[model samples]
Target chain A: MTNEKNKKVVIVDYAMGNIFSVKLACQKVGICAIVSNDKKEISNASALILPGVGAFADAMATLEKLDLVRTIKEFIASGRPFLGICLGMQLLMSESEEFGLHKGLDIIKGRVVKFPAVNDKVPQVGWNQITKPSYSNINWEETLLKGLSEKDFMYFVHSFYVLPNNNNIVVSETNYAGLNYCSSLREKNIYACQFHPEKSGESGLLIYRNFYNLINK
Target chain B: MKNIRIIPRLDIKGPNLVKGIHLEGLRVLGSPEDFAEHYYNAGADELIYMDVVASLYGRNGLMDIIEKTAKKIFIPLTVGGGLRTLEDIKNVLRAGADKVSLNTIAIKNPNIILEASRRFGSSTIVVSIEAIKQNDGKYMAFIENARESTGVEVFSWAKKVEELGAGEILLTSVNNEGTGSGYDIELTRKVSELVSIPVIANGGAGELEDVVNVIKQGKADAVSLASMVHYDYVKKSMVNGSLLKNQAEGNIDFLKFGKISEKIETSGIEEIKFYLKDKGINCRK
Candidate 1:
């Protein structure tokens, strides 16, 4: 991996996400990240990171109002490294059923749904372990799951889980009170996860390092 | 299974970190950022900075402290005390607080909770209820750092706050606070059961057993501690009104507030987590 100086990563600011922590995480890994709502800065980024926290419908509305929908699509189509975290990841789905039926960015073939009321809490707050598949067509070892194990814990605080249309895109899964759900997904240059790697301590910092390495390569 | 959150709650008075017995007779500890750094290194799951005098003093003074600490501490930080408006919430969030806990303003204007939650996510908003056990054996909510009683029942208020879109409920027992007695198990259990959102039991935690009891028996998703962790590291730190006089006399420099000593023999968060884990509590190792 190249330790390129002044490597710029753009965090798409639609005015909803936890952009502070994400930018700090990038700084921890020696990458300079700029949180920009401007389309030009986003399109010109070496790598794009979309970090979001809040309701899915409200986020979509902000993105629509800011007119970032097409710019994001074209950036992803360019095959540059891109990452979506938490609500940012949820917005990649075709639609979400949070509160009511609302549309998403549709970068990935999936729909966001609320966690089933199965005797457990609605929002699975706190640290939970992620399980990787034994075998898969995608190189799980080479992707964002690099240098990590199944027992590694990630911080998650959300009531909804994603159901992707294709299983091949799923890189890992986590089980919450007997209900297994998709935790991380990857499609070509795009990467997304339901968990917050920025808030997950040292193990989390490794994921950002891996992403930086991928972009640098 | 979800891991239980272990939070070190630091009560701040202006720049110095202070703790009181049942929220009175405030004693000055050193800088909050120092204690925050110590806790972060000790493997604390999260940290809470409560401006104890914010409501009474009419200003939240932890913005600069939070901004400095958030740069170093990567864990989630929840800031509470005197957050009365949407602009206040926005300012705290901009200063790098992961979540803002509302107590006085939430009870005064319930719409602030709705508006804050609507603007920021529900997860970013927490309703901190200071509960005191009444003579009839039921808990009543208090405000202004447990000085005034709202007379609203704990269970009903918790449900209402959840309905108002609070992501979590921080239930503190004023009767049990700083006394090292124990957390109010019955109150925590009732509030936790009444709401689908997470409930954090704060106030009294003297021993590992107190932490275990609150989570295992009381069903608290998280625990916020002050005296349990604070007293462990400082010597003769408990102040009874006279320290405030010394502070006001300009004889005491808060930077060199108290002598450092280890009163509690445990190895901090690691030991606590290990003790809890041995007792079959699933905590993050």
Candidate 2:
């Protein structure tokens, strides 16, 4: 991992995310991350990170304008490690119902839906604990949950959540206002978390470390 | 369950960090970088940098400080004060700030919230409301560092900002600010309950209990502190004249003569978290 070739990670920049914080987070973990919208740079990277913080429809429009949608699909199809954060994770779903109907990357069979108008806050901002599936036999310690406790808190700021058709891909869940929502998902080489690891303090940094280690493995 | 965020709000006047009583009589503390790093190391959930005199000084002047801190500090950095235009917000975000908080400008032009939120997402936009309790018990929103009243009620204004697409609300009590008496629980609770977005309680947190009360009773999602964390540090530094040296060189030493310290010990972020945890409050350990 110390070698220059193995230390590179590309953060997809479609002009709609906290690219700076994502790059800084990767740098904190000893990974040289480049924020690029170029297909060549993204495709040539060792691992790709998709980070976002905005409306899903607007993000999709920007990605389409940049013509990086097909590029992302090809990169993910290559079986390389891919990680998505927050809205970036939602973009992989089939569609989103934020303001109106919108299509997503459709790499995963899910739809992004707004949280039901309950008594809880709309965005569900701040730090919330992530709880792993109770009945799953999968060892989360070997993956992104490595070096993290079962209920460790992570920073989150989102008004919508992803509802995947397949529960097996769901890695962890978080409860807000007595409602359980998907917090993270894992499907082979592709991983995504709704929380912001870069902003989650030491626990967040450890998550990034684990993701980096996964890439190395 | 989401854990309450503990934030260290640093009020900056030029390069030096300063604190005031009731938002008056400014006293320079140590460097912003040092205090930021110290709080980050001690386990702060987030940081808010408010340029106290940015409006009076003509522009947002913490870009260098923000850049320096953003390079090492990984937590979310929110910058407030003197951010009026979309370009100013862009520059701050480009300098590595995660969020840009608006106050006076938002009142002057409410469409900025809509436009900025459209350009940079709602989560990146925060509306800071400084509320002062009026004679009739209603809280009125004040802008320009709480120097002028907007004649707008805090509750309706917060709701309006949320409707205008603001991601978060930072509600500060002008009466309780720098007093270290405690948060205006009623004011905080009123605003927090009125808005659907996350509300951050600012002004008046004297101890850990005060923070707990604000979260439990006031229902604030996050708590911001300046005097609670920096008062002792600024007081001690003033007495020892260690802070005076930095000011002397900058010709800003006249801001230090009013306050003195009798207390020697200051609580760090860790201590505050521990105290909160002991009271059965869930905070990041």
Best by DockQ: 1
Local accuracy of candidate 1 as per-residue lDDT tens digits, B1-285 = 778998999988888788777888777766788778888777788889999888556453578888988888878899999888899988888888889999999988988989988888899999999999988898889999889988788899999999999999999999888777889999999999889999999977877899999998899999888877765544333444223433442224432555322232323677788999999988778
Error of 1 at A210 (Å): 2.0
- How would you encode candidate 1's per-residue C-alpha lDDT over A3-115 as one tens digit per residue? 37566789998888478888888988887789998999888888899999999988999999999999999999999999999998999999999999998998898899988
What lDDT score goes with residue B250 in model 2? Answer: 42
- Tell me the tens digit of each residue's lDDT in model 2 across B1-285: 667889999988888888777777787677888788878887888899999889667453588888899887878899999898999999899888999899999999999999999999999999999999999998899988888988898889999999999999999999988776889999989888888888999988877788889999999989998876775455545666665555533435543554433321346688788988998887778
Report how closely model 2 matches the true complex, as a DockQ value: 0.66
For candidate 2, the docking band is medium
Model 1 regions more than 4 Å off:
A1-4, A134-140, B56-61, B235-267
